[model samples]
Target: MKVLLGISSSIAVFKSIDILRGLLKEGVEVQCVMTKNSAHLISPLTLEIISGKRVIIDLFEKRERSDILHIEITKDADLLLVAPATANIIAKFANGIADDALSTIFLASRSPVLIAPAMHTQMYLHPVTQKNIEKLKSIGVEFIGPYEGELASGERGIGRMAEPEEIVEKAVRMIMKKTLKGKKFLVTAGPTYERIDPVRIITNPSSGKMGYALAEEILRRGGDVILISGPTHLQPPIGADIIMVESTEEMKNEVIKNLEKVDAVIMASAPADFKPKISLSQKAKKESIQYLELERTPDILEEIKERKGKKLVVGFSAETSDVVENAKKKMISKGMDVVVANDVSKKGIGFGSDLNEVIIIDREERILSTGIKRKKEIAKIILDFIEKKLSN
Candidate 1:
């Protein structure tokens, strides 16, 4: 992978060295480009020595190539990354102000663009800056973070550059081969809530991390995603068509509604198995309700079985015992193409955890066990399996 790293004037320019090193560690060829003002903060010589290529500082710098320098740099780049991007550079890129080498490259680059903004909190929050960021986003430019933390001004607020590791990871995702390109997927996430009253409801402890990770991986692989998510604090992945639902019925309806448009269905949500048979119109007093009647919620998988028409259906089985056995049974009973079974009973994984260990079983009884891996890693494995199956 080749990444064109653009560095603009900012006090956070020092962090760009780490970003360069990280990308190099990933075996990515990085060509460094710096705004004129940034050269004062970090030496071009230092970047040249590390990247083993002369850094481009001047727009008119003489080169051996007959082609335009800025245009040539972007032609073979897989991604254009700006770490510690100053507000000035951002505005320049947003408004077609390309008087400098870095900004000129931004105008000429046709590859995926990833920006990590770093500026004063107040300047970053200004309406003009926000509008510029939105304009870039609307055109599919990705942003990592201007997270809340100690800033260059010594005031705590947003505008801190994301860690170098995070930026490199995002860049890698952007440059990954689009194996899932031109495919549409429906992914269900989180735990559904069954309302008992205006003030109370029944739900599970699922944090939705697994499902959200899956959606992100799918998007990274260039798939169009319809994410039917239950209530969770996690932000929806950029580029996904997000649908929020509270009850099992709502989730089912939305899934079925969009089922025909998707090439696959990844049912990652943990919907409430039962709901109050007769919910009270108002909040019931402690003494007013001695017992609560319950009934089974709608079965989304079963309902879609007849309507799916050969669409790949991937189901999840969160079990306490007989994990693989139960998942195999569910896969067969629901006509699922594959089933991911994980023992929620285990500690440090599953439910609200970021890590998971799953046994993936397919219709052919092929089983693969992923021993204790991050949910993000597991999501990639699942997607890789799905991609291979679809290609077959």
Candidate 2:
């Protein structure tokens, strides 16, 4: 696929090269275009070398071909992506002011346009810029991020350009037809920690990888996703509404609160089945402690059933024994539309691992088992199954 990458004037202009390289590595034909101001920060030669194509920086620069350069590139390109898209450029595009090569191409291009904004926190939050963004969105212009983090201005805020990998993912998603448009999802991930004392807690080994993968797939397919995540070190997927929680009770409350707003719920978190009946505020002395009382924590999947009318509920069962039989039992008991069961005892394919093997079971006794695969691939398989069921 052909992609036109536009770079604007920002300290983040340097990161645009990484974006170009990532696209090229993905076998995408990248054509680099830069605003005049961007050329001062990074030489166009670098981009030209990375993309292996002539860089377009000037509107009037004569080309060897007879066709107008901007029109030629924009007319046939599959996607037009603006990295480090500054507030100035966003305003220009929003207001239809196409004086420069990039803006002119943006106006002339019929292809899907995606802008990754990078600016100061105040500038990004400014009403004018926000309005311009809304205006552009109204016309179907897509955006990736001006992520929250430290900026070149020696301040931390929501103006950092999205990472190149994430930008590439969003670009690829934009070019593909959206299958889950207008759909909403609720996903829970990670291992919930049940506090026993001030310093002691009980938890599992879940890494939240599968849940995060599921959320990313939902976003890529044009769905809105809310991810309730337990304490995990993984970076939250871009475009997800992330709610951080600790104990099972918190996860349960958040899921219950948002369950009705979503079309489906994917329970991927491994909440501790039991918690200490009494949580002590002070740390207990190890030598003085006797057997602790245990009680079942709230069952999030089953509780959500009451509030999940007409909505699909998908549950995950990580069992060391009788994976399918136990999972099917839980699916029926918890009222899950579908259940994904995996054996954590399997080597290299569960718990904290990046790979997984799963058996997907439905209400009608239909079953589909998968070989060991990356969690991202497994996520897609699960979603494919859910999509078919939803359509039916």
Local distance difference test values of all predictions, in order: 0.92, 0.91
User: For model 1, how does the per-residue alpha-carbon lDDT over 215-305 read when each residue is reduced to its tens digit?
Assistant: 9989888889999999999978877999999999999999989999999999999999999998778888878877889999999999878
Clashing pairs in 2: none
RMSD (Cα, Å) of candidate 2? 4.4
TM-score of 1: 0.74
Strongest candidate by TM-score = 2
Native-vs-model 2 lDDT?
0.91
Could you tell me which 10 consecutive residues in candidate 2 have the lowest summed lDDT? 169-178
TM-score per candidate, in order?
0.74, 0.77
Residue-level lDDT of model 2, residues 141-236, one tens digit each, is: 998888899999898989899999999988977775588999999999999999989899989899999999999989988889999999999989
What is the TM-score (0 to 1) of candidate 2?
A: 0.77
